[model samples]
Target: MTKIGKALGVLAAAVVLPLTLSGTAYADIPFNQPINGNATYYDNSGFGACGTWVNAATEMLVAVPASYWTTPNPNNDPLCRGVSVQVSYNGRTITVPVKDKCPSCGSGHIDLSLPAFSQLADPRLGNIPLTWKFVRS
Candidate 1:
């Protein structure tokens, strides 16, 4: 092969490699599958990532990991489109709506509102290992 052709091939690979790798990472989120991770509580008053106001004390809600979020507008996200999650820990389980994004959470982790967290464990526990899955309502 000519030197120019080899150089062009290498350049093309360099240009496409990062995008391909990122796409692979983006596709790693298991949207409908059970996810094992830790759960933490947060004060979810005021505006949320789903572009709606929330009350931590009254509403049972959760902030899912940002890694699973792909929408340009939070309001248009699939999680915001009537998605809920059933979280289980220490024989306790509670279902909560996905109403926000947890920027600090990893792929399987979630941030639950105060009320939601209390149903699973004492708020003083702060954080706990849990398993959760998406639920349809």
Candidate 2:
């Protein structure tokens, strides 16, 4: 093949390679896990289920599944209240503290404070797919 043809072939492979690959590139977190889910935000006032009132515009916090709060589980006894969680979308990742419970969020889903959501993506995106995992604070 001519030089130009070979270059075109390489370029084609580069473009198609990522499309064919399955799964996204994310941090290699421990526990062999990255929980994938949908993320949304709620603008509200007053205290959260966790009983903490925070400035949503500045605080970096998230609301986990309400089941963890409404239902009794030994595993979350001390969700630590302010445990650090890593939230990722697209290629950006932000670490935020777990500050409340999301009674509406399903398993694997998390509700981020507006500020936390803005850190990883534009609020204009509305809802987005993301991956998250707990990390040592």
Q: Which candidate is the best by lDDT?
A: 1
Q: Which TM-score value belongs to model 2?
A: 0.66
Each prediction's TM-score against the native? 0.75, 0.66
Each prediction's RMSD to truth: 6.9, 17.7
- Cα deviation at 39, candidate 1, in Å, is 0.2
Kindly list the per-residue Cα lDDT of model 2 for residues 1-137, writing each as its tens digit.
99999999999999987544311211222322578987887666567555567665567788777654422532333453335678889899888776677777898888888888888888888788999876656
Q: If candidate 1 were superposed on the true structure by all CA atoms, what would the RMSD be?
A: 6.9
Superposition TM-score, candidate 1 onto the true structure: 0.75
In model 1, pairs of residues that clash are none
Which candidate gets the maximum TM-score versus the true structure? 1
Clashes of each: 0, 0
lDDT of 1 by residue, 14-86 (tens): 9998677556544554546888899999984888888889987678999998877766677756667667888
What residue runs in model 1 are displaced by over 4 Å at the alpha carbon?
A: 1-32
